[model samples]
Target: MERPIDFSRDRRMLCGICAHQWLVDLEWIDRWEQSREVCPGCGTTCEHENAPRVTVDPDDLALDDDKIAQLAWYHTSTLPDWPTRDFDPAADLTPETRRMMGGSKRVAAWAARQRGKALHVGTYESAIHNMLRRMRDQADHGSQFYLYRVLLMPSVVVREGWLIDPGNFVGDVVLDEVCPPGVDVARYLNYHEDPGGLSLALGRGAVAGVQQVAVPLRDACNNDWVREAVADLDGASDALVPATGRLGRFMRPSSPRAFLGRELGAALAGKLPVNLQDQFASAAAFDEGDNPMRWARRTSCLFDLIVVPLRALAELDRQERRTV
Candidate 1:
């Protein structure tokens, strides 16, 4: 005899338009999947069949040990060479030093300002989205991009809380305590926006080492689905006339966030959870300019951080390739 379906168990649901997560019964999920459901927090229609289901409690978005261990994290780089040695934030701050080292000052400065010493990594979609951003922003058509699969140490500690939200500050008080006598608090906060940097600087000891084998740009772009979505986004973007009025700008047809949201949502439709796809789209629409941290936070909160020491990373066979 076949086992009966259990509709009593709680199923977690996340709203893509807003980052709100909630719980429902399996029966409700079954019905919602077939039809449409409205998110309580944002009132947006949640109709995607593959909506993100939180594995943990909705109230506590933290990742447990098992979940962290099971998930695979990704990092992307535009360097001409493969197999990056290490991450260094200090050298990134100096424009002359960055130029001398032949690094993309934009990427370095972004990492230094946002992630600090901790390297910025995310889910496959986020990694590819970042690569696309670099390509569009820098106009570096000749550059090659590579994707690395990151492995974290088993014992690495994962922390919770949004890096940018003041309410979610992770207890580093050095900035508040050491503020200069007359410096404006806003300015000081702006200058020291790198929470990951501060965490690393404070000796938090989180580490993530990439797998030796890297996925080159051609392989990623060659995927039929990715190519089509990118082409659609490019076509849409090119067709739009620059917005001049408040109404036109408010619609944001020209915004990078909107463009990326539409692109990524379409590109990773079945591959990612509906909520995550929505989150990517929503974040792109709502986040300031093209700030990747907004979506990165969404991805990180769902997957949690992976920490692996360089010594702990094992070499993988080049013949093995993971599809995005």
Candidate 2:
């Protein structure tokens, strides 16, 4: 079993430098939620500040039963047919993408390797946080549009590289406060709003566009009906960096769609769609004002039974382990 350690136990978080030195039992996650943990050294607010948090452990999961039933109802009734997809860590990704996925945290990577040997599974946050450990590489890999393009964002970037400078890809991209190292990203994303109203940041003192592009995702498209159910599952998988809105749960209606287009028809709102408003109207439907997140408790139950055990990452061989 993975032992829970206090976040600030050894690491002293320096606000100005964004660097952390390991200490003991600091458990500073909640401290960041209330306010930014300042550095004892130079006293500048960090652009990024966070305490790592992972998926609720199965033993520690908090969902109830009724909500699980609702998720099942949506699966049987509302979800559109989809197909199966598979997760392959060895799959070639852009240099930047791997960086976002924490392709290089020695500790986290070591944990992953151990899992393969022991057939152990990782909580989603555990897998991704470890990948993002390379804070210094952000700029060399990408910038603001990188934040916009969650699709290709790198997991690891240098403090200087955090935001791609304003230029070819987009505009000046940077971090409002650099959380440097020892900052917890999961806790940060869940805690305070992005600096200056920017939900995502970039290079030092720079960022790309104000309008962030969201991806199109819905219950019908998910549920993996198009392919083998779990094969195509993206929401909760450690390998795939989940898009926004994971506070609820992954892979369900709780997560917002990429845009407020087809589903919530502009026809009802009286705004006309420039292209194929009719078609989009036919497609986008809230169905009911049911917050899918409420069903997360229930969906989690079914998912634990269906998806969790089937993940084969723990079964990788020595060669595969080395590659990951």
Model 1 Cα lDDT, one tens digit per residue, 1-324: 111111133555656556778777644554565656566776555355434433333332113334443355555577522233444545436777666657786655655543322334444444544444454455532345566665454554444322332222432334222222332121111111111111111111232344533323112123344445445444443333466776776764465544564456445433433323433333223223333433333322222211112211233324244321
TM-scores of the models, in the order given: 0.36, 0.20
On residues 1-324, what C-alpha lDDT tens digit does candidate 2 reach at each position?
122321112222223243433221223433443456544444433344433222112222113222211111000111121100122333455668667767767445644443222111123222222112211123211111101111111232323212211112321222223334532111112111111111122221111111121112113133422233223222332222344565636543432322222123333312321212232233323223323342222222222222332221221111111111
Q: Considering every candidate listed, which one attains the maximal lDDT?
A: 1
The segments of candidate 1 whose C-alpha lies over 4 angstroms from its true place after superposition are 1-62, 80-116, 160-205, 212-324
Off by over 4 Å in 2: 1-20, 23-27, 33-36, 47-324
Q: Could you tell me the TM-score of candidate 1?
A: 0.36
